[model samples]
Target: MTPDDLADSELPMLSAAQATHLRALAAPHYREGHQYSLESLAHTCSRAPEEHWPDLVAAHFDRLRQASQGDESAEELLRGVHARLLPVDSVPSELLGSLRYARVVADGLVFAYALDGPTSVRLLTDRDVERAGLQALGEAARANLMRVPVRHEEVGVEGGARLRSVYGDSPFVAGQALFLAEVAWKVVGERLPDAGALVVVPTRHNLVYHPIADGSVVDAVNSLAAYALGAHEDGPGALSPRVYWWHRGSLTSLTVIDHETLTFSLQPPPHLLGLMKGLVHLDRAGRLATRAAAEPAGLEELMRGAAESMDRLVQDPATLADAFRSLVSLAHARCAYDPDVAHIDTWDAWATATRLGSALFTGAPAQECHLGEDLVWQLPAFPAEPPADARGWLDALYLAIVCRQTDRIGRLCRVPSETLRQDDSVDEYVLHWIDTLRAYFSDGPSMDDVVEKLVATIETSGRDGVTHAPTEFVNAIDYQPAALFHRLIARDHDTFAKALAEAVAEHGGYWDGSAAPRARVALGPLAMASLAYDYGFPVDPAQPCLPAHLLNRQRLEEFS
Candidate 1:
């Protein structure tokens, strides 16, 4: 979707449909094998000649990243941006989960919009009673006469009159908590969509679902619901709702991750950090509990134990690693989808290695994912402060800890880019992860998954015996040009399906049986022996987490 398409869609801001089209248009530009540099991205997205725009992004994402790092005033500007950009339920995730902090003005606006029950659940607060439940949360919020207007019809009724609303402008962390919980609460109850490698977490930060009235109210006041939309923002203010200060460092931001690309202070307030941690624990517990309750008695027991195993982190390091790793992978998939993340920072290298990718292999049609609700609800105009879109701020944190494919997404997410933040070590782990996958795919037995696809790439080879890997290429893996076409550029179902069929036909039998690798393939371990050499994880039989099994077994029994 061209910017023109976006403008024509009458979307408040970037819609799901337009974004998908733009993604298709930009797909050909992501040539990792040719080492497509940032220098040429502009041509891929611009109407102007390649020489004119020079960069794909508008230079605003960087500015916002900078301002988020340097200026206190930028916090408010960031909030203002959220006010503009997140004007509706259109934010990449739930109302306010973790990407950024909020100021009073943004809070007020969010509350007013939410009071009408736009996209938000009730405003979370530690004070609300969990016993009150969703119904109660709604009732309490409704019963209290907020000075802000409710719906116009309700506003006119008796005692529906305005009262001095108590808007709590807490620390950045508090704002983050509210965002996560609101989003989480909403997600936990809904039938979430099947996002590829995506996790639609309703709760993030340390916020969890607490039943205590005060806890509930606090959750309400200081919570944000979240979703991880797959969007990229490397082109400066690509993260910005407003074009002017998008990445300008002057427009919006409370905190910026993906630290390496720009400068920023990573010092979150101690309380905020603690609060976030607490909320996260709560969220994990809730997920575990919910999953267990909804599941069969046996697995429920296991999940219960897993949830309770937080107590075992110090005593059971291996168990902790397994649990954490699982969580990390889930988070990584979502980070890929989050719109606010600088694409350059958040996308996996595999994502950039476009010479052999299937851009539309799994995506819905271009016409389906239209512009979002944000332009009206959230984003502001160019030069205007963008609504604070905290999806980047929060999700990137999870991406770092969970995806651990740090080298791939860290710089893109901005976490490693920060000179001030320590060696987050996120890359350290993710690199280890890539090696693990490489080894597993190489030396290990082939499963039913990628074998056929691998053979297809080889079979479909052109005269040079060079055919693209299903989602990657050989020579291109080493370097890439300014831009190259990938599969699925036609923006149609037939094209997507046909390319998938061809790729599958040629390579679909690599794992027809238990035979590991006759030769090198994308998921091959031999292709990544160096990776296995660097960091070790169990291969083949899948190593054991003995303690996890024992403790988790016990915990599940209790729940059962």
Candidate 2:
């Protein structure tokens, strides 16, 4: 049944003429198990105004008839085929027969291929796939789909949440969610948050998404769900009436359907629930950090707020590694804005990040890596696999180095350097820096070799670059860490201090008007400074990004 049929009490009563036209259209393709039964046709056209039923039915069949002719050359077919997301039940079961014609994508959705023409899109049958000699039809269709032009409008909602709706006259707009990461990046550029996004493809022409950055997601979910249900009910081309969580290229349905009752509700799975809780915690911590920075006299009260947020986050074992990375950013912001009052707060945040990072990455208990203690010496076994993204690997490496756990560093370096090169999403320059740092910390390369590789990476990154004021450097974040790493390994103390200040200043300028807490400070540069300070290198304590207390591990010494 179509989405509207699930909600309506009865399908629109079909006139004799409409019934005859539908049957005549279905006759050539009619088989016992096909989806073209009289009832199914009525359901399909039910959402359209009754007056338009005949045209809609005839147009759908016309496209199918054209698709069945299959006389186009393989190259022409490949160029015209595009992936479409549709409700699973909308496609004929007979067409799906063992041939990879349709594959289930989300809970009630399927990824199907279609041939696009000027006036209509035709669903490809098994015959179309055979004619094209395609072994991986889905892959080819998806590749072609990405070439479609993407356009979106940003809609700001209540509670500081923002939604980006990708909509156009193009029939392929809603299917862009299948390539969500690339589409989102294209639409929002670097502004898309690292925690991923919450998406709803309400109708075939509209895909709405909210990047998961703050506590607003709690409300955005309900808002998007209501929007989806309404749009699905009013559609000429309805897809799934559900919300999905898109993270690291994987899509998970966040809407649960109770088929028996013909009802559905939004309920995030365990992993997504954990991520949502993490976002909320980070949001609260960020507010407290901002307040503390702006009002240093109320530091104690703000610290209490920070403690409360941390307590709640600590209680959830599913809190993601990215959350801790944000926490580290908040900690560095406190040091940057009000170092004198933030000494203890900075240590607390960093210690918590290291403790949580150990637990999340190594599968160790948080208690084992207690706060206010010398960093744990007995490092747990590092995972055999590297993290899925550059930031994750960097977070892991930062935690290991800050805690002065060289054994963990060695273990991290052993997890296949080739894995770092696999993800095309990561900048090649960033990967070079990560590999160099891993080699430096593992003692696999001499300090000279490390400096040489890092310098080359930074110089190459800046060669075609625009310089941010205060320094002749590239504005990209990926290369800043490398620039700092080069300064440190070469022991160029003056340039290191100069670069640190410039990097911190550039960071603030880059995210100047943004509300994301992750924008407040440069975690990467601070992490690199922490390494230098640990090695007895002279680090200017007052550098805004490098919290002096954190660099010295002051609270660990005092409290222990």
Candidate 3:
């Protein structure tokens, strides 16, 4: 007889209403390649005849609905079910074992290909985990797995049995170790002997389960190592290597594997545990591990504070500048007082880039009086005082410049630009400026001469000239300050002069009852030219320089 014609005891003990609701939920999934249904779940649930199968199915649907609404605390849901339903008995075997289908975070469902025999299992990779109520669970599991301090240098397919043979499913590598082990057991545990299985774990890459062929964890590890090194004739003398194992379901380390020594350690080393714990917090912050690796203790909290402060003051340019200045100053003071602070040099570099970049692209002051703020931030940790260690200071300056330049390039890329008249054309001269600055910062024989030239350029500007009137100018706030827009204006002063006139004419003669805004607009090209020149880029006065054009016009307009 068909599934519908089965006896009442063989089918799900659901009321007609419950069966109808399940069919409605399972209908859409059935069309989308999901093979599970009330009938199929009943058939699989019958295998564990002692369990209350209907209650288990109801609980699964309840959890799925909650998970779909963004509550993905699966463990909590399971605990609640255990406490409420069938409280006298332990958790049902149907809940832990085969349930016809297991739904992951997205829209995919894992199905039991065989429930009673070899217990083949399969999960759909094509379905969307986010829509299927498994995305958060998947992400959390993936994040936890990434923090596992397992390193793999090489990955080769050798004599390891196909994962499909054991589970009728290909190897799956994403998600937490515990979750993966659960999937493995649900898929192939019935075929696996009761003595337990030997799992070959190649670091964080992939896991292959070998049905209980070896007796103990030590023997299992040794057998895997021998298989890994069996191809000695293919290369130089292949040596025995350390590998990991999954025994009964828990991850364990197998280290110090040689001809004489096979040390089986149940716990990961202390240092690795510390690093992994730090990584979990960093992952939550959406940051890379470079800074966190050295100083993982409070970096996430510090970054959160900085982000919150920035969000509040971003609209108020002056307030933002003040806050950034304070942060840079504090960081510099800390570094100077204690050079041994974890990754302080890197932190200083980041702070300096932020400070100088904000001043150039935003409207922060950069006077010689305030140059100490920048200098102090750039100073590297030297073993002795200067004169005897002058080179150290210079090295710090070089590194700081590189950091600043890279930061500026990234900022320019993110900002929008309306100045490019042609899409295909680029401003090549800006690239020349970057290369020129790099040369000046290099350790060549003419480095001293180049340094002198750069110092003279900044000194000639004088403290007032370098950081004076521009601080009062209104930031355009429209575009990210990029070289393309600046070069477009500087490509030909006459064309730019006409463009400025056109902009002013379009905006009703650039008079908002204030010369400050109009002057800032008119002298925008000049400000860009000044930045280039200050950074040691050569600008010919006779050429079509926007600053020179603006200067001559300012005298005529009597705006200065």
Candidate models: Cα lDDT each: 0.24, 0.62, 0.31
- Please give the distance, in angstroms, between residue 170's alpha carbon in candidate 1 and its true position after superposition: 30
> What's the TM for model 2?
0.54
The TM-score values for the models, in the order shown, are: 0.18, 0.54, 0.20
Q: Tens digit of lDDT per residue, candidate 3, span 1-560?
A: 45454435313344344455445544543323223335445434445443455565665445443332224244432221100001111223434333323332211112211101113222212232233334543444344333433322222233322232221121223222344444444544434433233444332123444433211223334455554333211212111122333334443443443335523333324432332333332222222122112233243344344444444444444344334433333332333322222343434433442443334232333221112233332121212111111111122222233233444343333222222211111122222233234344344527555444444433333323321111111112111122223334245554444444343333222223221111122222333444444444454323221324222222111100
lDDT of 2 at 554: 55
Best by lDDT: 2
Cα lDDT tens digits, model 1, 281-310, are 333322111221222123234334433432
Q: lDDT: which is higher, 2 or 3?
A: 2
- The C-alpha RMSD of each candidate to the native structure, in angstroms, is 30.0, 12.4, 23.9
Compare the candidates by TM-score and give the number of the best one.
2
Better of 2 and 3 by TM-score: 2
Model 2 off-target regions past 4 Å? 1-68, 98-101, 135-139, 190-194, 287-537, 541-560
lDDT of 2 by residue, 458-490 (tens): 665543321111112135345677778877877
Look at candidate 1 and tell me the lDDT of residue 513.
Answer: 24
Q: How many backbone clashes does candidate 2 have?
A: 0
